[model samples]
Target: MLAHQQQHAVSQADLSVLSLLTQDQAPSPAQVASSSSARGQPHASTHRSKTKKGDGRADVDPLLIAAAAASGPDVTRNHYFHSFFPHPLAYSACDDERAALNASPPGPSTSPPAQRPKMESRQAPRSIRLQVEEEEKRRLERLERLRREQMQKEEEQKGVLQDKPQAVALPTRDGGFDFQEDGKVQAQASQRDADRIKAPKPGQVRHLQDDSLVVLLRQPSTPPPLEHPLAEPPFPTVGAQSAVKPESPLSAPEPTAAASPEARTPLPPLEVQCRVRTRIPTPHGHIFLHLYTNNHDTKEHLAFVADHAQMASTSLTTNAVEGTPILAETGERRLLPFIRSHSLDCKWHDGETDQERIVRGAYVGRLTETTHIASHPNPHSLDPTATPPHVHRSHRTTHNTSSQAPTDPPLVRIHSECFTGETIGSQRCDCGEQLDEAFRLITLAGRGVIVYLRQEGRGIGLLEKMRAYNLQDLGHDTVTANLMLGHGADMRTYGIAGAILRDLGVAHNGVRLLTNNPDKIKQIEGEGVKVVERVAMVPRSWVLAEEEAAAAARRAARKAKGKVSGGDKRKSLDASIASLQSLDASSRRPSDSRSTSLASSAGPSGYSSRAPSDIDGELSDGDSDSSDWDAKTDSSRAYHLRRAGVGMIGASVTSSPELDKYLRTKIDRMGHLLNHPTQQGTLKRVMSSGGASTPGATHQHPLSESVTSLDGSSGEAASR
Candidate 1:
């Protein structure tokens, strides 16, 4: 009965509570019926008292009573009432008795049970049923008894099944026990026979509920929120509690998503600024370095030194004995580890090459290095049994494998190292463009090298170089400017370069030189080096213009074909022609006025080609050139003239104020030639239908002030 009540209670209680209990029990039919009937009122009642048996209690139907008890805790003391109708007493006896009782409706014997009095007996109606209510009561009692017995039997069977021995709850650490050899575990008995019981001893594994056989898994937990990792004192010893802290792995630290290098680490040590002094000997010259460094840093300092000039830090060492010229001898120098202590106070020095040196130093260590280059060798020839003869490797490569190994391409550079022109974008020279072009080719080839020699200002360095530039700007030509600076014209030499290149293994037999300087070509070729090839560094502007011209020509052709040639197309074409003409003009300018005047007298007639006559009056005679200049327009010739004139003017003015004054005196003394009558060479020559002419007789062309200044300075121009 108690179990029945409990099951009913689980069904009737609020779902949440029932869910907490049986998990699947739904509300009982009685509660559903009550909720449906009452509609608005709460179905649960309070203050329940169990009804006692045979205590003059009001008779209540058992099923109705059971349903009310199911709705929550009990409610017998409450005023709530439930209504039900029971079987009538007349129908209690038998099927025939019931049929006769119903058939005799409304006659004397047909009176209802409620209306019949206690003495209304007339043989109790001969056809009336007797003991009907008693029989029904007895049947109901039997059914209830049967249900109770079935429930009790089911419960007993369930208990027996649950009590049956299951696989023993051994420690998961050992794959659950072997039931075959040792045997099965009996319920509630002292474990005297089980060999390997999985439970906590006094000092072994932790214990949990023995009866429940639950094997609880325990993990090390994080401490409460009272402390943060940084604030908490570190653990003094293993397992010692210093403060509440985050759990971390024994071997490493805890992973934090927010932590970064800046946030996770402490500030680095303060930097100490100091300068270091070192000496480096190269084939070119002895280079002395004054490097600035932080005493706290090592790698950056060494890197800076290495890149500034490919100067590795090496110590001087002496060997007492040696055999060959190449081998170390007494007083012979050997490279060793280079190290120096840090210092704050440093001495500084002044040098003529300081500016170029600084510029070179700026990118020290910035360029990447090739440390482990792949080697190509004849594997079969380097027999495993014998030492290889082919590999006589340099310091750069690690090994000498075989004679047939692929030789690395010789390092080469077409260096145009001019200071002002390269760095400041000076249009006075093509040095910068040449340098870029050379580098581009070398980089494209990948295996070539560029030795960026710091011979700026033509090896005179920036200060003197600037002074020379000042002289040139003041009217002295390139030659006169150098003379005024107490230097020879082109005061530069390639001996140092030759030596450096040789030291780098770029022998005449190995390198393919790239340069247009004829003097350089002659000098380097003669310097025991094989000049296999001379690669020219063409100007990028020339290439770009050519590409643009081709594109414009294509566009013009298309427009003409479509009969859509507009005024804009013509204008663009004219502009391009004019630009080309200007370039042509500049190139034709003479270094002397006499030449310009002679060319003018000869004029377009001097050219064997008719193209010169085509653009005859469009440009000055000063823009004249050999047939080679015909492809360009007259304006281009003029541009070159103006540019040359400017350079000449600058050189002439800086040659010497006294020299200029003297030049004026000479010009006056030579007035006859300046104004000679019938000077046919002075007359402008116009091209006829035929071609070519020579100088006129008995007349000489006079010098212009610009031409005089340029040629009078002395010496020939530097060859490109």
Candidate 2:
């Protein structure tokens, strides 16, 4: 532009000759280097205004060297404030005027081997010649892609490379090449994402495990895009956009190396359902209660279900098989009064007028039999996730095709809450005998469910499940008292029971779970719940009192090692010490006919046998000292299950060797699925029937001996 207005009129005449040389008084750099210029005579470098490390006087401002000598490089090198930033015409001249300004020819400059040709400005017509012909066709396609990557790096350094580019380099909108990421192709895409980018490096101490799925999924360490490797699919996919591939004479199925990265990664779904179901009535039966709502979690999760085609329809449970008042075959009898939320969504709005369509929620069987509940509700059924209207079909998504479905799926159970094992019945844990054997086997398999997850205890609540039951009564198990009460050994989740079994259409033909928690059937199976038959609960009164106290403690330990009678026929301690000291003198003949049989066979033990002294401790402490001398001469010792006490109901419970070390630390440390009682016996303290007391303490009397002085003022957890 007229050489930038003649270089801003020679930088305002070199700032009016350096404003009369700074009003006269600081010249000495050889008197402003032999004073010459009033205008153009530019040679001033008496070597001073630069050395700034110390002799002090080099402050050099003079209007910043007259604006870097009329915007430096003597202003013509295509005048755009060309950078190197230090140009006071590169240190204002004089080493013979910088060797005559680098031996001449700078005026029309623009270097890198002569460039300056851009002259198109009819007030920027055609936008500066289409931005200089798109910067010279992107500088001739970056000089033909760096001369075809310098002829394929000299044909792979002269091995005369033949055929390689199997098509991967994608990014290219006029590609200004900054390709750099190949440190052996980013370390082979980081060693093929070395099993999804693992991290823990700094000081590397990571141990975090309460059965780690990152402590039951606190998840996110950044892994998810699980491998794509561009075989032409980085984009365009949804509804498969067909740009033209009509030729398919049965071929395309190629991708094999046996596929699977879980079929190339999918999982993470969840969503939820059942906005409000109800019928709760529970002292062992009627449980509709689906009440869900999910996108993952916000507590209030539940399920219960037991479906006998959603029972109660004998015009609401039998007026003797009355025909159709089952909410008057769907017209909702009079707008859902007390039937516990069903409205399977049949549809009928009829321009809405029965309490705005039963508060915008019913329609399964009728949609018009005889109803009205006065009006006010349709504010979009207060959107508990809208999508309703299922008069007969609509709600799909668990992919159920139904060729007569039911391969026997249905019975679910997820459970979780314990409130000290279902409301104060805490026998330290059998979670209320697996929540009443999951509603008595889903009410005898009339169809199933049972999600009930307020995740107490397992997710640790009820004041940290009473501080993990005082750290499992100070003995810790149930997964080390939930990892010493911080939690996670079973944090419970089932994606809101797989979104209330995808809103009760029973998520496909699958379920039958109840559980032994292989992580609660792998977190309620996945996607739309699947489980398929697991059942195995094992409680029926701790299996008939642990199989009649392990078949009477193995037939009283094989009839006390078979007849070690005072007639001593000893095979038990591998015989001979004169028949093992005449079978240790007939095992001290019942402690010499009882002188408190060796301190009533001592107690305080969580587990410790040691009384044998070699002969494999006389064959493992002589079969728990012959089942503690047949429970000190059996006082009707049936003892197996049913304990539930607190405010008393099925109360009696006295297996106390402290509730058999709290069900043996909930079956060997809180994994509590239950069946390990073939016989690990230890317990034995129930005293007080009044007489056999101070000698081998057998005091049996419990069929409620008038609360024997309220068991010495209770609370040792209500006296075990």
What lDDT score belongs to each candidate, Candidate 1 first? 0.32, 0.38
What's the lDDT for residue 339 in model 2? 20
* Residue 48 shift from truth in candidate 1, angstroms: 99
Clashes of 2: 8
Model 1: how far residue 569 lies from native, Å: 21
Tens-digit lDDT string for candidate 1 (1-720): 853453334223244332322322334765455543433233332101122233444423334533443433323322122222122332233455466567776657735444222323465543344566667889999999999986776466445434534331222233222111112345453453243354524443322322222211121112122112222222111111111122232234332211222333332322322233343432212333333222112312211111111223110111111210111112333221111111211112211111111122211111112111111112212223211322111212223334322232232553535665556556665565454434333322222434444445554456866786677677755545544555433433443344334333344224444542334544554444445443333233332233334445655776577754458545754664464343333222212221221111111111111122233322222222223444466644533332233222112111233333322322222121121112222211211111102112112211111111111111111010
Q: Please report, as a residue range, the 10-residue window in candidate 2 with the lowest summed lDDT.
A: 598-607
C-alpha RMSD in Å of predicted model 1 compared with the true structure? 38.0
Question: Which is the leading candidate under TM-score?
Answer: 2
lDDT (Cα, tens digit) per residue for candidate 2, span 1-720: 743343233243344556535542334443333333433333232221232224445444544564444343343434433554333333342364466557668687554432223445556678888999999999999999999986675445334112211111212122211111211223333232232224334453232221121221242121112132223322111111111122331234332211212333232344444444444555435666656544334456777765443353322221223221222122332211112222223222222222222223332211222321221222113222222211112222434244331233455677777766666566655666566656644644344677777757554457766876676677655555555443444444455555566555444545555554444544455444655444344433333353345446755866776745633424433452233333322211211211111111111010011112222322232345444433442221211111122222122232345456665554443333333444553222222233112211112211111111111111122235
Question: Candidate 2, clashing residue pairs?
Answer: 329-366, 330-366, 345-390, 346-363, 346-391, 478-670, 545-640, 689-699
lDDT score, candidate 1? 0.32
Model 1 spans > 4 angstroms off: 1-411, 414-416, 563-720
TM-score of 1: 0.26
